[model samples]
Target: MQKSPLTSTGEALLRGQLQTLKTSERQRLRHVLEEARAHGDLKENAEYHAAKEEQGLLEAKISYIESQLQSCTVIDTSKLNTDKAVFGAIVTLENIETEDKSTYQFVGEAETDMEQNKISYRSPVAQACIGQEVGDTVSVDTPSGQIEYEIMDIRYS
Candidate 1:
């Protein structure tokens, strides 16, 4: 499979989650399973069965995270150029029609958290902003309609 791009922050976040799962989460599950096992027979114990199922899901998640880490190319956002909007750039824009302002960080897929205003580099807004500089107007086709935005500022790090 082709390696996917990831920001250094995203890589660190994934590594932290993996560590938590391997240590605290695993230990907690083991304790729960031990407690369940002491309750009754293996075949009829609902708690034991549930714990086993949860353990399977946890293991699957761990495996998925490990694979993702292995298949990613982490890029440090701080080393990028701030002159033009590009991957790992935090771009500030102003809506052409409404005059509303918004800021978004264009990052790799793994760091696309809407709540944090981090958008995927492959997203429409990011694609429109890429290679554009301040004062450049970009049009994006959304589900509602085409929206125009002027780039106000671009920052990296």
Candidate 2:
């Protein structure tokens, strides 16, 4: 599989989640399974069945996280350009119609948090902003309609 580019912070976050799931979550699930097993027969024990299902889900999540970590390439944002929008660049844009301003940090897929204004590079807005400099007007096609934005500033941290 192709490796995805991720900011150092995003990579660190993924690694941290993976570590927590592997150690704490795994341990907790193991204990839960043991407790459930001690309760009753395997055929009709609701607690044992639930714990086994939970264990399956937990293992799947750990596997998925490990796969993402294995296919990640960390990018250091400190040395990136602040003049143009790019991966790891925090872009501030003004909505042409509403005159509202919003800031978004372009990050990898694993770290895209709409609530926090962190968008993935593969998203429409970020794709439109890539290679665009400040003061440039870019349009992104959404499910509603095409929205236009003017780049106000680009920052790298």
Q: Indicate the residue-level lDDT of 55 in model 1.
A: 100
Per-candidate Cα lDDT values, in order, are: 0.94, 0.92
* TM-score for each candidate, following the candidate numbering: 0.95, 0.95
Candidate 1, residues 2-102: lDDT per residue as tens digits? 98888899999999999999999999999999999999899999999999999999999999999989999998989985688888899999999999999
List of clashing residue pairs for candidate 1:
none
- Prediction RMSDs, each to the true structure: 1.1, 1.1
Local error of candidate 2 at 23, Å? 0.8
lDDT (10s digit) by residue, model 2, range 65-152: 8888889998999987567788999999999999999999999998888998999999999999999999999999999999999999
Candidate 2, lDDT over the whole model: 0.92
